[model samples]
Target: MARMIVAEMCPQCGSLDVRATEPGWFRIEWDRRDALDGGWVEHLEFGCRDCGMTWD
Candidate 1:
């Protein structure tokens, strides 16, 4: 039997139906205005259509 190495999944419910949530102000919110800024955290939001769950 074949085994899955690393399957990306939703933490809420065990389902593969997952989609990436768009970032409205991705560039403006994430990008630093100048070089002086450092150690900024980034997020990748995901939404599950099956159970209507969202997480980052």
Candidate 2:
């Protein structure tokens, strides 16, 4: 199994005030064959209604 991580940031202004209008799940992949292959692989989806910005 792999662990996933997501961040809230504004793509336009690069602000941390980014909020999630829609919440969802993100799937991550891990490469057991490689030592440093296990990390953040995918992001679900999130949209900021404040600035009308969408990010993952």
Candidate 3:
């Protein structure tokens, strides 16, 4: 199943059109079960849909 993301108010424009974006290639999540191989892989980023503002 896919995850649902709630939009947040933009600090610069005050619009509830914020969305999470992935700018990097990937991210690692340290999990106990995956310790033998490596960490969980993931990616994430944040930005405002209306204003096109991005954050780290």
Estimate, for each residue in 1-56, the C-alpha lDDT of model 1 and write its tens digit. Answer: 99877655788897888887546534454445344346433446788878988887
For model 3, the stretches where C-alpha displacement exceeds 4 angstroms are: 1-7, 25-43
Model 2 lDDT per residue over 1-56, tens place: 99988777777877676655324433334444244434433345666666777866
Off by over 4 Å in 1: 1-7, 25-42
List residue ranges in candidate 2 displaced over 4 A: 1-7, 21-43
TM-score of 1: 0.49
**lDDT for predicted candidate 2 compared with the true structure:** 0.57
Q: What digit string (tens of lDDT, one per residue) describes model 3 on residues 8-49?
A: 677888878878765654445545537644543365666888
Provide the lDDT at 33 for model 1.
37
lDDT at residue 22 of model 2 (Cα atoms): 26
Ranking by lDDT: 3, 1, 2
Of candidates 2 and 1, the better by lDDT: 1
Candidate 2: worst 10 consecutive residues by lDDT?
A: 21-30
Clashing pairs for predicted structure model 3, backbone only: none
Per-model TM-score, in order, reads 0.49, 0.34, 0.43
* Residue pairs whose backbone atoms clash in candidate 2: none
